[model samples]
Target: MLEKTGVPTPEQVKRAAPTEDRLKKGPVAVVECFQSIPCDPCQYACNQGAIKEFVDINDVPIIDHEECNGCGICISQCPGLAIFVIDATYSEDKGLVKVPHEYTPLPEKGEVVTGLDMAGNEACDAEVVKVQSAKSLDRTPVVWLAVPHDCLMKVRGFRRKGGAE
Candidate 1:
């Protein structure tokens, strides 16, 4: 399915996902990079040394969940927009997913947005918790979204309210 379509399969996603025990700990980086292309920015972006050093540039990133603090510093560094920070322990009913955004008319903080899944389909309604657009992040800005706990993994991207699908 991944070869036929750009979207990854559930099994592929599971390979990259941290363990349930890890998720309950706190926020952590989730690298959804299924392909082994030339990419290493995510490793360099991780200050905690969680992302293992790549032996070959084409190797897929291997994250050390124990070392990752989920600072989200690597979110904007990914050119493929594959890296995300998920905090399943945010609240009893809610979780936070930090995704990279490069679109115009960025969703404002405290605004409600239509959360999109990996297939770019509407998953649920998410609230914009924060927007980090510092110049250091290059041109890509990171958007922090507060979504239902069940939608934590489902919601990877979002569309502004009444915005284009």
Candidate 2:
């Protein structure tokens, strides 16, 4: 039911998808915010003002992808966990994706885990490249995964070896 109607279609993602060059430059914020809610934390969280403030709280957040250095400060700031930092230049054959992980038993660095797509489906096996859980993050851990270059845009999150926590 979700995939058929609830989840975004490929065409939609393609329309808003960042270019390969942009992804390769450095880390960029990929805001998957599709709904309108009273939220402006993303704009305030970014010290660079990469994310524009909404005149109306219900307006969706607007990000100047070019201005985003992909620092990932907004990742944890977003209460909805709708932000992702994609670094296509992580390696020649690998890309790094930073996702917000709120589940317990957080995966450690260098751990091999199942990468999940936007629809929460296993997309590939990825290695945990980095795990940041600073106090400023307020318990929201940012998990970075080293996934195949081709899956840079596809991989969104990760699951532990045994199963999802």
Candidate 3:
């Protein structure tokens, strides 16, 4: 349930899912996040010291897969609900997209959730595979969605259709 406003497209997700071979040989690279409000947890979460040394805390997170373990520690640390993890290397059937899911009545694994884009509009349908959270994540659940190969670049977020916050 994206907003009645600017919704993202699957093509955007595709364009956004560009590959970085360096991540495969080393740590995972994080991208596709455009919003800069209320975030910067990635700096403190990176135990390897890859993020802090590379940029300022106020700056956006620039992950160096060379040191990233894809541990997803930073995925939950975000506050604006921005940021995600994408693995285009996954099988042809689908790929992994880790998002900061912070809505009530969160969808369950295997449940078909509504895929949304940056503007908070419907883009496609995706399946929820993993939903994780810890006290450190600040109540934000790191939702892993199994999205169609085509939806990779378009589906930036999720929408539950109708509900109250």
Candidate 4:
């Protein structure tokens, strides 16, 4: 969850979508994170000083979206299994969740998968629409998928068909 100094919080993200309508005509959250490891590449990745010190590297890096302009610098710089971008207004039918997936035998873009919540429970269905990877993004392979609006904050991970649990 992003913690922009003047943006929103986990609670605000829950209260009412505090995100700009990117699909329409505004900015959105670009989180390329997944794990809670001891790192801060995302913090250093941000030029607007959006992602700041985690206080503890083990803690998830927070993004100040107000200060952030949806620049995806942190998305490709993160080393842990954490980070993602959530456009709450991606679509009226569904919200797009771009998660930093690094599992081997990666799924193709347009593939469908089960979006798992924090508890690893299947909360909703997500389909990969875009796959961003390069020598720079490392081997993590940030996968961009679309999910339900209500499931955005709940989703934490995903598993493909016949994939590991």
Each model's TM-score?
A: 0.97, 0.93, 0.72, 0.71
Question: Model 2 Cα displacement at 102 (Å)?
Answer: 0.3
TM-score of candidate 1 on Cα atoms, chains taken together: 0.97
Clashing pairs in 3: 1-159, 3-120, 9-154, 10-154, 12-153, 13-152, 13-153, 13-154, 14-153, 27-65
lDDT of 3 by residue, 1-165 (tens): 213434434453444343556423422536544434445666777787655553444565565556666666766765655457666656657777788877778777777878875666677877888778667677888888777766665576786545422
In candidate 1, where is summed lDDT lowest over 10 consecutive residues? 156-165
The candidate, 1 or 4, that scores higher on lDDT is 1
Specify the poorest-scoring 10-residue window by lDDT in model 3.
1-10
* Global lDDT of each candidate: 0.91, 0.86, 0.63, 0.66
Model 1: runs farther than 4 Å from truth?
Answer: none
lDDT of 1 by residue, 1-165 (tens): 988877889998888888999999999999999888987888899899999999999999999999999999999989899999999998899999999988988888999999999989999999999999999989899999999988988888999988653
Residue range 32-128, candidate 2, lDDT tens digits: 8777788888888999888887799888988888889999999999998988988988888898989999998888889999998878889999999
The lDDT, on a scale of 0 to 1, for candidate 3 is 0.63
RMSD of 3: 4.8
